[model samples]
Target: MADDSKSGGDLEKDQRSQEDAPPSSIYLISYPKIVFLYPTFLVAVVVAIFMSIAGESAQIGGNREHMAEVMSLIFLGVFGLNLTVLAFDFPRTTSLTLFFLGAALFMGAWMLLRFNPDIVPTITGLLKGLRPWANSQMYWLFASILGLIFIGVAISVRFDYWEVKGNELLHHHGFLSDLERFAAPNLKIDKEISDIFEYLLLRSGRLVLHPRNQPRAIVLDNVPFISRKEKQITRMLGALQVQVRPDNH
Candidate 1:
C-alpha cells in the first residue's frame, strides 16, 4: 500500500510538470494602422490648388481658349484628393485613385498648353518666373487644398485601429458608433523583403482565416511593422497550443 501511495504522488508531480512546461510555438497576428507623411500630402495639395486658381482665372479672363487649362487644373485638384487618401495606406483603393488622378492631370495639362499660348507663358512664368505673386492663385489654391487633405488624412489615422490577443483579432474603424469586428482564425503569415516602390513604400503582407468552414481566405495588405507582430502572434498561438497552417486560397 505504501509503495502504491508513493507511485500515485509521483504521477501527480509528473502531471503538474507537464502542465507547467512552456509552449512549443506561438503565432502573433496584428495589422498596424497606416501612417502618412503629412509633408508630402501638403506639397501635393499646394500644387493642386495653384493649378485650380490658374484654371479659374483663365476662365474668367474671357480667354475662351484657356477653358481647357481651367478644366485641367480642376482635374489636378481631384488627383490631389485621391493621393492624400492613398498616402493613408488604402491599398485596395490606391490603384483606382491613381488612375483617375493621372488621367485628369494628363488631359488637363495637355489641353492648357495646346489651347492658349499667351496664358501658357503667363502661367509658366508664374510657375517659373520667380515673382512672389507670379502664381499667387495657384499658391493659395495649393495651401487650401493641402489643409483639407490633412484634415481628411488625420481623420483616417485617428479612427483606424487593430490588435490581436490569443485567438481573437480586433478592429475598430469609422467614427463613434460605427465599429467593425473581424476574427482571424487559422492565421497564416508570410514575410518578404521586396520593393513595393523602391522603398518609398514598404508592404508587410498577411493572410487570415475566414473562421468559416468554407474554403476561403481573407487577405490583409500593406501591413507596416510586421516582424514584431509576427513574434507576438506566434507566442500567443504557442501558449494556446493551437495548430496554424498556411492558407493558400
Candidate 2:
C-alpha cells in the first residue's frame, strides 16, 4: 500500500511538470496574395463538375442550357469580384461592408431590370445575348492551373518561415535550409491588419518583430491567425522574462 501511494504521488508530479512545460517553438508562415484566389479555384471545380454531369445527359436539353447560362454568369461574377478584391484594398471593416452593400444593390437593380425586359428592351436584348458559356474542359483546365499554383505556394512557404523559441528567433529559408538567428529576449512585436478582406479570408495580418540590437524591424505579411500567434509569443517571452529576472531579498 505504501508503494502504491508513492507511485501515485510520482505520477501526479510528472503530470504537473508536463502541464507547466512551455512550447518548444512557434513557426510563422506568410502566404502570398494569390492564396486568396481559392474561391475562384473552388468555383471552377464545382462548375466543371456540373458541366460534366450536364454534358453526359442528352435528354435534358432545355434544362442543361438554362443551367449552363446560370453557371456561366456565376463564374464570371465570382472571377470579376475576386479580381476586384485583389486589385483594391479594404483597410477598414466599414469600407468593406459598404463595398459589399453597394455591389448587392447594383446586382439587385440589374436583376430587376433583367426580369422586366419591357423596361429597357435594348439593354435586355444585349443582356440576353451575353451567355458566356464554355466547355467543361475549359473549367477543368482553369481548376488544374489554380491547383498547381496553390500546391507551389504551399511548398514554397515551407522553405521560408520564421521560428520563435524562448531565447532566439530563427529564419529558415532557401532550398539548402539556410538559417538566421536573432535574440528573442526583449523582442517587440506589433500586429497590423491592413486589409480587412484578407483578414476575413484567412485571419491574416502583418507581424512586425523588433529583435534586440536590430536597427530595422522584420515585417512578415499575410500571416494567418495573427492574434493567436501574438498571444503565444507573448506568453513564451513573458515566461522567459519571469524566469530570468533577478530575485530581490
Top model number, lDDT: 2
User: How many residue pairs collide in each prediction?
Assistant: 14, 0
lDDT of 2 by residue, 1-249 (tens): 999999999999999978766677999998888998989999999999988987733333654456666777899999988887788888895766888899899998798886787898888788777866677888999999999999999999999999998699999999999999999999999999888888888899999999999999999998999988998899889899998999997
Quote each prediction's TM-score: 0.37, 0.85
Task: Name the top TM-score candidate.
Answer: 2
lDDT of each: 0.52, 0.88
Residues 1-249, candidate 1: write the lDDT tens digits: 999999999999999978764444333333332233344444545555555555534444653444435444554565565455555433443555775788899889868866765676877666443322224455456556766765765566556655565456555566773654445455555554232331244335443435434355545544555555556666665655445554577
Residue 235's C-alpha lDDT in candidate 2?
A: 84
User: Could you tell me how far off, in angstroms, the CA of residue 66 lies in candidate 2 after the best superposition?
Assistant: 3.4
Whole-model lDDT, candidate 1? Answer: 0.52
Candidate 1 wrongly placed segments (more than 4 Å): 1-39, 42-144, 157-160, 173-185, 191-195, 202-215, 242-249
Question: In the order shown, what is each candidate's alpha-carbon RMSD?
Answer: 14.5, 3.4
